[model samples]
Target: MNAPARIADFVINSNADDLAQQITLLAGQINAATHRLLKLIAEFDTCKGWSGGGTVRTCAHWLNWQCGIALGAAREKVRVAHRLEELPLIDAAFEKGEISYSKVRAMTRVATAENEDYLLMIARHGTASHMEKLVGKFDRVQRQRTDRQHDKEQENARKLVYYQNDDGMWVIHAKLPPEAGEQVIKALEAVVAPIQEERQRELQESCSTDAHGDVSAETFSATVEHEKRESGNHFQELLEHTRADALVKITEHFLATSAGGTSLQALKGAERCQIMLHVDIDTLQRNGSTHAPNPHCREFEHQQWLSPDTARRLSCDASLVTLCRYHHRLLHQGSFSIEAVRDEGHDSPALRFISAAGATIETSFFPQFPGVSAETSPLALQRLAPDVDATTSCPYWTGEHMDYGMAVDGLLRRTQ
Candidate 1:
């Protein structure tokens, strides 16, 4: 019989009270042997290419084909074996059967020369799962530190730039701090709320009407309930349309009010918005001399660029207000405002521009004229009339009407 058959026969026939103890010793011996075998594999792999026997490309590949081991297991063994060379303490523990290969593998991932001693102690006393958890926590902390550093770099690089495209459309590019970006997103969503609700109501009404134009309340109710249930799934869809609408609202608000010389305080309760513009005193007088060549002549809201003519128009009646930052350690002068909007659950509220005296200046500033689109051109304001009536107009209007031109002229005089 072969030596293997002899050992099998001996193992089967042997009967003693110490058999279990002997099996335990055998297990330790096998573990120690495995440590030595891995070291030899590592050395053979390192020198394989020089011998022209490296057709398998890698030691792990050779092991997979020659020993019939799974590629994943072979690769893991190769990795651990190579790492063990740099981890003398861990290699010693493995060779002495004080720690299993599973524990060693997890340790080597996050272990460095500085922490290897502490990690080896843990591997000797703790279970494999415990070792794995420690490694995971270490990796997470390291990643967080790296992320904070990256965010700081990004904040330092934050900027806003604008230029006119070939088609005469203004293009704006902005980089903002994470918190500031979040605030802007929230503000945009708030502005888009009524528009979204109006669209939803129209959709429900259309669904409720049949071919004969007879409305069904039951169908409308069902549609409303269904929409509410699926609203979360449609956040991405709503955000896209809402973003476009918000941009239009912002541009219209700035051009209509700021260009016409309205003060920040005057727009209070009308809309919660702010804009900054930089213009030279010379430019505002429409002098033939130009500062367009100097970059300092044009910067708005810290990042946007304005053409000299546009800057001149906006600065006509601009006033400076002091702003506090960083716990009052710094103070600077600029135009800004804080305004509040009335909250009406499930109902679209009317939008009105209000003055400091709490009188409404313009009603339905967003929807504008009946035939005019929300995306109307800035120049279109000359042709379209304001949507003012008894129901839509503010209580302060009192039957007298102010056209866009008259309103702009009034704002200019008030600011001056």
Candidate 2:
């Protein structure tokens, strides 16, 4: 009988456990022999020893035509064969049948002379999946290091440039730091999420609703298919429109809020967004001194510069008010509030802006009082003082008679 027939007869007669053990042993032997064969093919290809000599463009192509192997398998074999030359430990492990080809394949992608020993140890003890995961982590770490190095080299090149085009439209090109760029992207995506969700809900409801109540199965199937296609096309258009709308919302949100509060406040540390503007002490006291030049202040929110008069107008209405950050969040959830402080005599009150907890002082005032005209509402003074008698005329009171009694009556009614 032939050797194969003899082996088949033995395998057919053997017990289950023995057959299983023998099969595993034979598989390892086949794997080891395959590596040896690949190494020999690599050596022959290196010397141009094929039938066509050096005429073949690649060893993989030569193997595919001559050995009847698939192109993908031949290419893989040729790659591993070359890698084996540089990886002595892995090559030895393969020959000894201590590791599988799957493990060795993953190692070769990231293995270098410096890391070969560590990689070989992992291949010897770990499963093929474990080896793949290790290789992936190694690749990610290497890529992150490379990215940081590239960013450092390009640090000085970061800038924002603008120019007016021929059509009279302004074009802005910005090169921001990686972290800042990521934050901008995240903010835009956050804004787009709800918009996409709302559109999807509307589409789902519209697609499922049928005016004709009852329908045949065939008709129902056709309607569903048509609706699916229609919804898909509408979804694409919705995505495009949502992105544009989100950008506009982000711009408006940033401009309407001051330094202490921004729409993007959730994405950044409160301290990072806190802007401090230095003014002359005399100007702050209204002594007619010119405001100091604040070089630290830069244009924000569409790059619009704040004029001196505008800055002065904003400062005059600024006030210190205390509220918890959670309360601030609730207010923003319901409606936005302008930060304001209660002006007290020259003793800068014990209020320092706190951003640690959600509690902080806002420097702008809310314009929600009655009797304040829309034109002068923003400029009206607010008093939270306890000693101020109700009989005194309130600066905020704007009624026909400007009398103390009228002011007292309005204050009591508003409080009640």
Candidate 3:
């Protein structure tokens, strides 16, 4: 049918379902046409049709100017066009109108000949949003793995060296990871920036003429002092001298505070930043194998999984909070009961765990030294473990011993 006749008929007779079907059919046709257009663009790019003796920088630039496509979208089209030439399966799917341009665009970003079939399968089954999310996650995983490897290399290469040169001047050189280097730079700038600004203001003020159209006596004196200071190799020497003085001040402050001479509140730039890690107890204690699912370590901030060794290194100077997987599983499986307790003598509420056999476990907190809770008496301890006498004193064993090893082995031995 002719274009006008089909439109007139559609306007007169179309129902909702018919309109939906026609829209779907037209979308398919548009996709097929777009596939052909991309094919032409690829061929044109190969022939350097838009190069025009280097007048145009790229085919995407030409498209943006002549075809009125947005520059970013034009670049994406060009990239997808070139990529499709290499992936025959995706190219055929695009030509057959089985997938839209959006899916092709996303797949081409992370696709290779080895993975093209898998990507095509996903494009066939998943929506554009799914494809976008999959691509994003894949990029993040790849980037994180790369970053971890790079960080390890940087850490191994870190060092600080100092020596006295032949001129009796102390020289220092340091190599640090990005985060540490940034902290050092910030500390130096924090100390030096104000001094630099003050110097700049003095220079501006001393050079300015007074309101009476002549330099004031104070200004002239200040200018003469400034000139005397700037007599030879002025700007660079002054800057280096100021930085050296700031460095000395910073070192003195650090030594004073570290030696307990005076306790100054931490400066904003000197505050420590903590990295949160989620790791299983077994992995943390034993440096267990990462291949095991139960002992895996993950970084909370970046959502990246880390190796056991890295987790241990991070935990060296860190405050630890542990959750045992085995105990958690047992708790979930109805092996124990936990409840909040707030007695008349207690200052704060605490969690109490009771075994299935009605034996109360230790309380979460012990404010004062009632070594063992009244609920868990020596008789109850003997009832739980008949082999060991509850009255026997062990140096490492105490009612208030909250260490993980003691809790897991000594205190919870009866439960196991």
Candidate 4:
């Protein structure tokens, strides 16, 4: 919201009554609306907005301005609406407004199209808890589909084979399957796009001394990719969007750096600068030098293990892999990897700390106070950890030390 808030601490401190009331109100609202939509759409064979014109071409037009979504997004919504009417159970739930409209839309995609039976069972006799279990099952199935598609592309990718016509038109051929033909094209383009971007960056840099020349993937697709898939080309279009999302992510990494950078469209078969990471010391070791104080990725590991927002930010493609790597390396040794995964008691996100070595002990960086600050007030790290506490000397910290490190001016820093 509003271009993601610059990283901030969580400052919520609501009472139990407030939390319960908020949840109940939301639940009631969703149930009421979900029921109304299902009842309205189920009884009618065709929506007033839609008729048998069935242009297949007609769907894309609706997606843009009117629907406020992409062409693919609009068609998928229509497809789900159509499928909902086909089933009595989901349609009935829709009529009851037991779930939100958006939930129904997501369920349509995630719920296996091939397995109508699973949806039917839930529709007939299932609670919200049951639906959640079903959603997990759907997610697992979708993950499997994604995996198979990846492997198929890898094995099916081909080597180049060319044919020269008498008129001097040379046609290049590749061995990849129909599903991976786009991927093949993508691989070849990756090599070409960066070269062109470099030329542009150099040209722009030469034009002005003050200007930070940006040579991103936008120019590559514009100058190099002359042909793009049309509306009906669902699978291919989705694949390309996925690729674009990835490229955008790479470009965002340089935002943290002073140097203006480029995002080259350098995607090959199953190669998209992707990394599978977890909360562990091993991850930090790979990026950081051995002599570095904290060679482990304890901070990243803890964020992944403890906080959802930090984990999401770290996992995003938009966050450059390079920056994340650098961030990992900067953290102190043994200090980074999160070991206490199973959270035992209620925890606050005031000040999170990472130990350089020991696992059992975690120092609470945020000091607690009766008045502290208003729930909405900005926190001052200095107040949490004062420079010289009542005890004149700095506390000697150890693995067994219960006291978190001292507070520096408006910040939490190591004691000593």
Candidate 5:
């Protein structure tokens, strides 16, 4: 029989079980062929042929337009294709049809020389869904380790930069992590709040008076035009100027208190600028409990309430102190003192707070992370990565309709 006649006969005679086995076998063969396609893609990418001398944006975009693949999927394919070059065991398994493209895709996301073998083992033993979930969990663990390391370096990275511009104006730039940045914002807002209220009150009084209603339309229009000329923007320009003025006031107040006042008076000014938060002693001793009867924090000055989670975040800094009401009042009254004590085996001096009556107020607040102690080093994250497996050394893909770049506008191109 001819080849077509024999293939048709075989298909006509096959039972359900036989067809299932054949389908599975063909699927494996397809996966194996996909590995070869990805190998070519990786070679092309490494040669920077994807650039096509600015005609093509990226390898992924070329794949999308020429191969009819979705852009997001094409990007993933490109990423996987490049990554598989570094993972040999996965690559080999994919080439041999021992694993499907789905499995290879999941393994490639996190596989490295250290964990490739373990990942391959999972791919061989598990379904695509199982492998995908495992990969997601592994990535989360890796991210958490990175975040811990970042947290350790954050303090050193904090900086404030200032310079005079060519326009004879000063420019200021600051980089602060969320908690520290929030403190600066709160201070500026506290100083600006009274000014905002005063402006609103004046506007209200003006509107209530007969004189405000007597203003001609031409006069109102001239006032708006004058404001636009001065501020150089629309309505919000005035608010921006107000904030700029507030920032200057804060800087001046800080400098004045720093250079001219007694240390106690300076401390008072500093404390006045802070956002007053009230937290229960027991709740703070706990890990910011959500089940507490009052899981809310009250803003002492603004009469606003904050969730326990927010309170926990605000209190996470090393400089945060747990002051009793009596001590807080004494602090404002200049009836308390702070002295730096150099303890044994400590690099930095510990601050000790004392009342005028000579009693010690040894309250302190420190950030708490679950399962992590205050003494835990950033290196602790190294222990969280998955253990390396010894079974595999490699990485895979599925693609079709491959094409090389055609001569376009008299230029010989290679990536399409």
Candidate 6:
């Protein structure tokens, strides 16, 4: 650790002269941000209820809820308010009315911390006319290397991966349209039901004929040959000849012990029509890896306060937000969200949230797993959100020079 840094942490925590302004700014900024963000959180959860909590409607409903004006006016209000959440000193400055409504919106929406900070500083210290000048400077600074990365990510996400296979089949490997699910279920039922019924009838007739007056083996063989020689046969018919247990075993063998040459892209887009469901904060962070394990996934969701289990729980049937195999880690240590659903106080913690198109999903914070719940009182679970941190002084550097000191780097390490 550097000498100045070790001392700076001390000063920052204690309000030494150089850090006095920064400490004041940090605390006030955090407070101001808390109110605005809390409103956003409430709005998000509220829209979750009122908007049927789908992807599109939650955002639209939230915009409507925030504005309380006409739809167009409310949109503008939401746009402005969300933009203001980006400003460096926005909450505190807005609280004090140092900047006008229009200026706050313009300044906050510029899309970079550095530019926002610089422009906010200039406007605070410069004339009203200086807003344009500050914005211009901010733009120029943003085109530099650092600011370009976020723009690149957004652009990359837009460029989806889509292609067609050799069989003249369409492949949309990304998130599937949730709209087609019912048709799919109906189609599957149509295809499978007759075969299943046929299997039951054949099994019954074979046993019945053998039970009293036996049918000749020649007749049974003739029926089998006729089925095998039928003009059109789908895999489902062949599957009926094999019992469900045998089908499962054979399919597993076909997949796992298949020729190594297979790329297995058939599994890629099949889960797309399934929905992504989730529980609220208390359950999300404590659960597994189905949600945001990386930055991009995190941002597309809430980005903040997301846990892998929470994300995975939400994306249970989702092909788009595919959770890795080891996603069960979200509940390894016993998370609070899993408990809250079972709390005696909760009348019915289980809920079904539907999308705008009427795609319904059943979600329960309290899953029916055998050993887990509020009743079980599992290990080391923090039920309420962790307390707002009181400031603490680290003494890692006091003993001697060290690499990176005791300050943790990386989000995973910090969380773990």
Question: What's model 3's overall lDDT?
Answer: 0.66
lDDT agreement with native, every candidate: 0.59, 0.59, 0.66, 0.43, 0.63, 0.45
Those runs of model 6 whose alpha carbons end farther than 4 Å from true positions after fitting are: 1-50, 53-56, 65-88, 110-118, 125-129, 144-416
Residue 251 of model 1 has an lDDT of: 61
On a 0 to 1 TM-score scale, where does candidate 2 land against the true structure?
0.34
Model 6 whole-model lDDT (C-alpha atoms): 0.45
TM-score, one value per model: 0.35, 0.34, 0.37, 0.27, 0.36, 0.25
Instruction: Point out the worst 10-residue segment of candidate 5 by lDDT.
Output: 407-416
Candidate 1 lDDT over 1-416, as tens digits, reads: 99999998777777542565445444444445567768988898787731222123478766765555688899888888899999888787677655667778898886666677777765555566666776766555555668886677668878898997878787878889898888877878877888878876777667755665555678777876777678966856766767788878866677667754656333544334555654433344444434344343222324444555677566545654322343122211111122445445413233343333354433111322446554634233212212211221111223343243442233234323
Candidate 5 colliding pairs? 87-394, 87-395, 88-394, 89-393, 89-394, 90-394, 90-395, 91-395
Local lDDT at 194 for model 6: 68
Residue 62 miss distance in model 3 (angstroms): 0.4
What is the Cα-based TM-score of model 5? Answer: 0.36
- lDDT winner among the candidates? 3
Residue-level lDDT of model 3, residues 1-416, one tens digit each, is 89999998777676765766655555555566677789889999999887543335689987875566788899999999999989999998777666778888998987777677776766676667666777766655545668886688688879999987778798988999999999888888899999988985776565877664566678766775777676757777887888888887787777546644556644334234546677644445444446344422222333456677888888877766433655666677676767877655445455667776666754322223235453534354334333332211112222342233332232123322
Per-residue lDDT, model 2, residue 56, is: 41
Error of 2 at 379 (Å): 99
Greater lDDT among 1 and 4 belongs to 1
lDDT of candidate 4 over 126-155, digit per residue (tens): 344444455555455444658776566557
Residue 83 in model 5: lDDT? 89
- Return the TM-score for candidate 3, rounded to 2 decimals: 0.37
